[model samples]
Target: MAYGVENALAVCCFMTPEYQESKNCQKELLYADEQNVPIIPCRIRSDWKPSSWLVPELPTKQFAHLAISNKSKSGVLRKTFLIGNTHKELTRKTAHGNTSEWTFFVRPPSSDRDSIETYIKRIRVYLHKTFSPPLVILDRSPFEITRTGWGEFEIRVIIEFQDEWHHEDLEIFWNLTLRDNESYEEVDVEFDSYL
Candidate 1:
């Protein structure tokens, strides 16, 4: 039934038992090669030699021996997820015809700020899963906090987002907090000047 609905230009494949333990995309790509369709291997595994010259080799390497194509050069798939502390969950969505399924979720709490970079990098590593659009959906913003001392420090931020994003309806605002050193008293201020 899957084959009946697939495009002639698309690559069809079967999961060989040998590949059951492997998360490598090469095996399925090899199958696509048999169908004369272009295959995009997520990454190359040192242990596995590319069995055949299935698709044209991409000039850049993504993961290990895996070559990423021109379409994937921008790393669009990996940018969908958000990483932060206090609020962090991953949600992925897949759609077919009129029926759409959403797998994205904020499963784990963002308690480890130190590990945020590692978490985000790992999310980017799974770009293969998001070949399609908007596979990941994050909550409003990631972890954000403002800590000010007696003096101010220089910072950089874009007042607006890139053109590709739908920012028309989005409202972005920030709040500042002041914590007393001696008493450890806390005060919330909408404007930085008040603190």
Candidate 2:
């Protein structure tokens, strides 16, 4: 059944394990509620919860990326390398429909830093499985990968360096969310730091 925006909400009347895994069901549901109104996903045997970050009345799209900095010193070379961690988060809930994209990036402090790119490239190869596509690195300036999903979830990022002294890679598990900044006070405070 086609769900109208004015219908208040859409409740999955029936949910089968097969249906849950099918791409058709996801596409249909995405179309059914393009405006991103609170959708009551199938509860037949699922524990999925609607995203709390979205507020429909505001009618706005959100695009924000979170960045984490990792610093390490090479004991052998006695030099320190700075790695900037960031993500690409995009959420669109307009008349067009509700869509989102989440990607992660690891790079040196500046665009012209080629030496640091070498380390980033090696880390990308080492953590290929962590990425969705698992592509090899041809450039080292920035290593990045994008994930696919309609709902928000936590993603694990592992960055390995070429430091002989440090044998372990830096691992980070981030929960990616995109929503109206005004609705979340913590998000507001975090954004303030960038400014």
Candidate 3:
């Protein structure tokens, strides 16, 4: 148990009366503290609180509740694609300096579109510093970013949820390219239902 705690990225400590009274659990918690590992306190029982040896080790913070429901659905899978089209000018510009138009899209599954549209508040896309007003915010559907450039750079995309949802903004990255090809990336996200 100590070995497992030492190698773990973060320890999920389930707060319960029995867990606090166990000697082995105390040793594992102490070893994790000594190793400077992050301990995430999870509340299994609503009425349980840290006492005895746990008082000094656990900080006074809102513990995450482990709520399991048989009716709760799994995460939704969404795809983000980047498509680039390059065109060479007939003027005195070189081949490397050809202008390229790129479009970035965030598409949800057809079955989950309604849920995504209801929860998502806005989409923000960050472009290269060279572009005028590098930040673009879209508050409606067809979440996309279109830009014409002469070079390739990394683009940052952030999907913000409604204030009532209490969800962290989803962030994604795409490489803006001048190549005549399309790139796709997918992410799975779980959203809590109000019902």
Candidate 4:
């Protein structure tokens, strides 16, 4: 919960128990939760050392959003990409209880025909190991691969652009939380698009 607050957008690195130990962080988490600010979780290698990027600059505007990007060693073009999460209630029930599922999608702000296909394929390969029966790929508009799960769990989302400009895959550690009617607002989908 030691998050970098910018533009009211809270960006926290791959969390560890130690990161959430501080009383100050606990306060920030509670405050952010109360404010209904969006939290973006950025995944980094376990061995990667802390850096300036972990703590972002203070916000100057009342409303702000967080954009987490990973730059190459040279700090040129960003090697990172974005993913989004949406939770909805499933009519079916799970063994645990009422089953609500969260869907993770990679809908880039924009993309060409070729790029969209590449993204779908890439996502399919990325999710192969974890998502049994595989993710269903829609053959129509908004070309993207989506996977749903009953519970909130951390899933590694690996992104590689069509060009493959960057050799290494950028990983996003996403904790997909289940949302129900009482917890969800109409604005949730609208808010997710930006992420």
lDDT of 2 by residue, 31-136 (tens): 6556555544433323232233223412343322223223322112322343222333345543534365544455433434446544433543323344446543
Clashing residue pairs, backbone N/CA/C < 3 A, model 2: none
Say which prediction, candidate 1 or candidate 3, comes out ahead on TM-score. Answer: 3
Q: Which 10-residue window in model 2 sums to the lowest lDDT? A: 184-193
Q: Order the candidate numbers by TM-score, best to worst.
A: 3, 4, 2, 1
Off by over 4 Å in 2: 1-98, 111-114, 121-141, 163-166, 180-195
Judging by lDDT against the true structure, name the best candidate.
Answer: 3
Q: What are the per-residue Cα lDDT tens digits for candidate 3 across 1-195? A: 877888999888877777778887788777888888888878755667778677777765457987744345532223333222223223444455545556776766556536456767898888888877999998887777666667778888888987655568988787765564566655665554421
**Local distance difference test, candidate 4:** 0.43
lDDT of each: 0.28, 0.41, 0.68, 0.43
State, as a TM-score between 0 and 1, how close model 1 is to the true structure.
0.21
Better of 1 and 2 by TM-score: 2
How big is the positional error of residue 162 in model 2, measured in Å on the Cα after superposition?
Answer: 2.1
Let me know the TM-score candidate 3 reaches against the reference structure.
0.50
- Name the lDDT value of residue 165 in candidate 1: 30
Residue pairs with backbone atoms closer than 3 Å in model 4 (clashes):
7-64
User: Model 1 has how many clashing residue pairs?
Assistant: 8
